[model samples]
Target: MKKYLHTGILIVILLLSGFLLWRHSVQTRVSHEVVRVADVGAIAWVPFQVGLEKGFFADEGLSISIVSVQTGDESLKALLSNSVDISLAGIIPYSFVALDHPEIQVLALNTFAKDNQIIARKDSGVSRPEDLIGKKIGYSKTTASDIGVEFFLKNHGITKGQVTLIPMKPFAMPVALATGEIDAYSSWEPNIINGKKLLDTRAILFNDVLSTYTWHGSLMANKTYIESHHSSVLAFLRAWKKSAQFTKDNPTEAIAIASAYTKIPAEALKQIWSRYDFVANPSPEEVVSILRTDLLWANLHRANPLATIPDPVTLLANINESKI
Candidate 1:
């Protein structure tokens, strides 16, 4: 009886030990969820850049692979074609495709601010807003800069016909301005800063022109992806929230990450760092309002416009304010 009792005790202890080991393994297992992201290499995408560099996503049990593109429109295209799981897109491009592509959805707003500006060559006879008339101004069509340039011109009482609007890529705008290919160009940072460097004292920047129009940079994904990978999506947003706080707490480090990722000089990023408000979740109402306004702008500008503008109620469905 003593021998049998001792054997039973030993077996029970062994079983308990094995169960604990299995539970530990289960608790500490690393998730293999890989999220591919497409982003435009710009200062506005600093939160994602910082998060990627700092391994915030890793801490949340996710692996993030990022692809760089030149413009937000390109990033959106990547998202739509299933080339990427998530994309950082501007409100302007999102508005253009929202109705057509019901699968695309806005996960969160990353940054909202007025970052666009008009950079002109002082020698081109553009001393004031009125002087932009009859001058060849380069701008990226179908992006926020296009509408922003229009708004700026309208505010200054200059019609679109008043100035020769030259369509050019953002990266080419600086060189175009430097070589006198275009008298002035309306664009956002890095390009704006580079244009200034090329022209030196001849560069004239109108910073306050786009103040009334707020540009929104958002994280977008396909509705199907969000539905299937709900937990992973939540994890991404949580990592993004952590990164936003990290940026706020350590602006210097965040600027360094942005500089490295964008190849923009740290000094240039620092100059415009305060212009952005990094928020993982922007108000849904505000987003809908902006989309509605941008849709109207797109209808007038896009070659193939939507038959009818999506109502606010319909547009709101595109936004998913998932709390992290």
Candidate 2:
């Protein structure tokens, strides 16, 4: 009887150990998990690019395919259309979409702040914000540049009406300013960087100097996808966090990755690289601040006055910060 009892106990223990091992294996086997990431091709997204080059995504049991869009809004549009799993774009643009699509979930705030400057040609004789009055100023409508210009003008008591606002493509702004088509242009990097190199221009004002949203690049996902692919989401964030850390620790390699990916010259990327703050996860308060600022910006620029402002709680409801 004693021998039979001991044999049964040993069998039970072995069975339990075998079950635990199987569970571990199954949890790690996140195969065929593909993440379609649509993002702007900028130095701010270097961490993700570095992750792809270093196999960080695969290490987390995910396969990621990146689609580089011309602008952040385009990337967000792709997300809204269900053409991509994740969208990496500016907070203000995200806010515009989120007001209508409350189903959007934010994963992480990847970058904070940029040097959106008002670049004026030296010969234009526009030395300060006040000089912009009655002069044609070029900017991409409703973008960071527009927001930056608005706040800068507000600081100097110059309204948009005071300036002959020329709506121009960002790439066209530098040339327009140089060739006397427009006296000045409000643009962000690498265009601004390129403009400086191609023309004798001076930056009169940067976004940081103004009372604007500043700008943050965030990673977002559709709510349905987040709900169903919880593990996958966590895995992606883990990989992203790793990449961000790697970038900080290895600036030279990070610069190279960003230059190659963005097609911005290495020197240009380096000059403005420090302007970007790459954070893998944002605090709840930070997320709320960004959302609130976006709402205010949209009210001013997007003509979305009737849009409901999202509170901090509602904004952070879907943010998964467990790993960070």
Backbone clashes, each candidate: 0, 0
Looking at model 2, the pairs that clash are none
Which candidate gets the maximum lDDT versus the true structure? 1
Over 4 Å off, model 1: 1-31, 209-213, 312-323
Error of 2 at 162 (Å): 1.0
Best-fitting candidate, scored by TM-score: 1
lDDT of 2 by residue, 179-198 (tens): 88988777666667667767
TM-score per candidate, chains pooled: 0.88, 0.82
| lDDT of predicted model 1 | 0.81
Ten contiguous residues with the weakest lDDT in model 2:
204-213
List ranges where model 2 is wrong by over 4 Å.
1-32, 200-213, 317-320
